[model samples]
Target: MLEFKTTSPEETFAFGQCLAKVLSAGQVVCLVGDLGAGKTLLVQGMAAGLDIQDAINSPTFTILNVYEASFPVYHFDLYRLEDAAELYDIGFYEYTEGDGLSIIEWPDKFPDQLPDEYLWIEINSDFVNNGGKVNERVIRISALGTAYEHICEELKQICPFLP
Candidate 1:
């Protein structure tokens, strides 16, 4: 497990970009966080690292957004999903198992549907709330398989400033 703290959205996105640089096809990353935990910002950094020049936004309404970069990237938002069954119905398995990188938001809503071998990331806001302004955040990353461990190590190297 890797733990880190960020004080701003830019730092959070930079951390995500570091990880994104190491991502490739057939990789699934589940992001667990609350409503304003910077999940989308992290995804933005990941997309930037992947060399995706297009805009990266939360696919809350569309459910999934596909982008082409160094490799295919499939971004999914499960916040609107009623259950894991809806994920299957939307052909989420195709993305998770296909030749593309899959990044999912609100994965807690579909724990059983999540891939067992996928990487997990949890983001939480620390005590710094004044009218909904977060001053600190905690991000926990866990590697669930050998492939994910390799990716984590690669991400570690992607940013020399990262600890």
Candidate 2:
């Protein structure tokens, strides 16, 4: 596991962009965060690093969004899903096994449906007890597969704040 801190949304996105530099086909990144915790921002940065020309946005309603880039990026937002069955109904398995970089948000909704070859990225916010409205964002990364472990090490070198 690796932990890093981001002071702002842009930093979060920058982190994503940095991670994107090392991404390739057959990569699955599971993003676990609060609603406004900058998960999408990180993905947008990843897209930028991947040379995705078009804008990248959250696919909460659409469930999935695909972008053309140096390598394909398949973004999925499963926030609305109630069960793994719903995900299966939408061909979630196919997406995970496809030849592209898969980035998923709200993966907890379909835990059983997720492949064992994914990297879990968890983001949490911490409040400063002695400060006046200041917060620290913690980003934790856990890689399950050998490929992901190597990719994550590469990503850490790119992200200066990685711990």
Candidate 3:
């Protein structure tokens, strides 16, 4: 597992960009975090790193957004999903299994449906009551399979400070 802390949104985004440098096709990244944990911001940085010029945003209502980079990027938001069955309607399996990169938000909602091998990213924010240090976030990343393990290893090289 790799863990790091970011004191501001820019740091988080830069971390994501560093992460994107090691990502390739057929990778699945599952994000777990609260409402304002900067998940989308990280994804935006990843998209930028992948050379995707289009705007990146959470597809809370649409469920999925496909962007074209060197390879396709399948971004999914399961927050609004009322049932796991809805995953079928949104072609979750298809996109995730395709030769593309998949990033999922709220993946904890249906953990059983996720691929056996994926990169799990959990973001925890330290919210101060007095509105001090509001942007502090602790991010933990772990790999579930060999491929993902390699990604984590690459991340360690790119982010030397990761513990």
Candidate 4:
């Protein structure tokens, strides 16, 4: 696992921008975080890196949102899902196996349904200890595939804050 500490929301987003530099088609990124833990912030930065023009927002109510970029970004928010089977209703499997990049939020809701190999990111905050600064976050990135393993190494080089 690779770990990073972001003192502000911008830093967290910057991390995502950096991460996007290493991403490619048919890749899946699973974001696990608490409410307001900067998961969407990171994705927005990724949107910027991918040159997505539209505003990036959490797909909480919509289940999924697709954005234009070098390759399509299939963003999904599974927080509202009642069960893993509901994934089919939103074409989750198709997107995951398709030729686009997939970004999933609240993946813990259906851990078993996720592909065997994907990027898993965990973001946690220390608001209580940081005087309630909502932006303080520690992000952990892990690779479950051979390609992602190499990508993580590349990320460590470009991301100065990764430790």
Candidate 5:
């Protein structure tokens, strides 16, 4: 596992941009975080890193958004999904199993249905004594298979402070 800390949204986004530098086609990245945990912000930085000019928004209502980049980026938000079957209805497998890169938010909704090999990221925020947001986050990244393990190794090089 690899871990890093960010004190601001910009730092979180910068981490995502650094992460994107090591990603490639056919990769699936799973993001687990609470609401307002900066998942979308990180993805926005990834889009920028991929040279995508379109506005990157949370696909809460749309469920899926396809962006044109050097290859393709399939972004999915599963927050509203009540059943794993809904994934099939949205052609989730087709997009995820295709040649493009896949980034999924709220994948914990159907954890058992995820691909066998993928990148898993969990973002947790720090709160003040009064439970107010502090704009601080600890991002934990891990790999599920050999390919993803290599990716994690590459990430360590990109973010030397990761430990």
Candidate 6:
């Protein structure tokens, strides 16, 4: 597990960019966070790191957005999903198991459907630092299996400044 506190959007985004360097296709990153928790900002930075020049926004209505970068990136938002079964209609399984990097926001809503071996990131406001601070977030990252565990280890080595 890796936990870090980011004081601003830029810092969070930078962390995302740093994280992207260690990402590859066929990997899933499940995100758990509340509204306006910088989830989209992190995704934007990841997109930048992947060399995706297009706008990266939360696919709240569309559910998923695909972007071409160093490798394919599939961003998904489950906030609007009324039922977990809705994932099937969007062919969520295919994308999750496909040759693309999948970053999912609000994944805790469908814990049963989440991939068993993936990275899970939980972002929340850091109220302890809320004194006059506009945005501060505590990001916790965990690896579920050997593959993701290796990735987490690599992330720790590459981004030792993530405190």
- Give the candidate number with the greatest TM-score: 4
Question: What is residue 78's positional error in candidate 1, in angstroms?
Answer: 0.4
Q: What TM-score would every model get versus the actual structure? A: 0.92, 0.91, 0.95, 0.95, 0.94, 0.93
Query: Any runs in candidate 3 off by more than 4 Å, and if so which?
Result: 129-133, 160-163
lDDT of 4 by residue, 1-163 (tens): 9999987888888888999999999999999999989999999999998888999999999999999898889999999999888999899999999999999999999999999899999999777655677756889999999988988999988986664
Off by over 4 Å in 1: 127-131, 160-163
TM-score of 4: 0.95
Weakest lDDT window of 10 consecutive positions for candidate 5: 126-135
TM-score of 2: 0.91
Q: Please list the C-alpha lDDT of all candidates, in the order they appear.
A: 0.86, 0.85, 0.91, 0.92, 0.91, 0.89
Tens-digit lDDT track for model 5 on 43-146? Answer: 99899889899999999999999999999999999999999999999999998899999999999999998998999999988876665755688899999999
**Which ten contiguous residues of candidate 1 have the minimum total lDDT?**
154-163
Tens-digit per-residue lDDT, 66-161, candidate 1 = 999878999999998886778767789988999999999998887777787988999987655577777777888899999999977876666643
Better-scoring candidate (lDDT), 1 or 4: 4
lDDT of 2 by residue, 46-95 (tens): 88888898888999999999998766779999998776778777778887
Note the residue pairs that clash in candidate 3: none
Q: Indicate which candidate wins on lDDT.
A: 4
How many clashing pairs does model 4 include?
0
lDDT (C-alpha) at residue 36 in model 6: 78
In model 2, state the lDDT of residue 20: 85
**Number of clashing pairs, model 3?**
0
Ranked by lDDT, the better of candidates 3 and 6 is 3
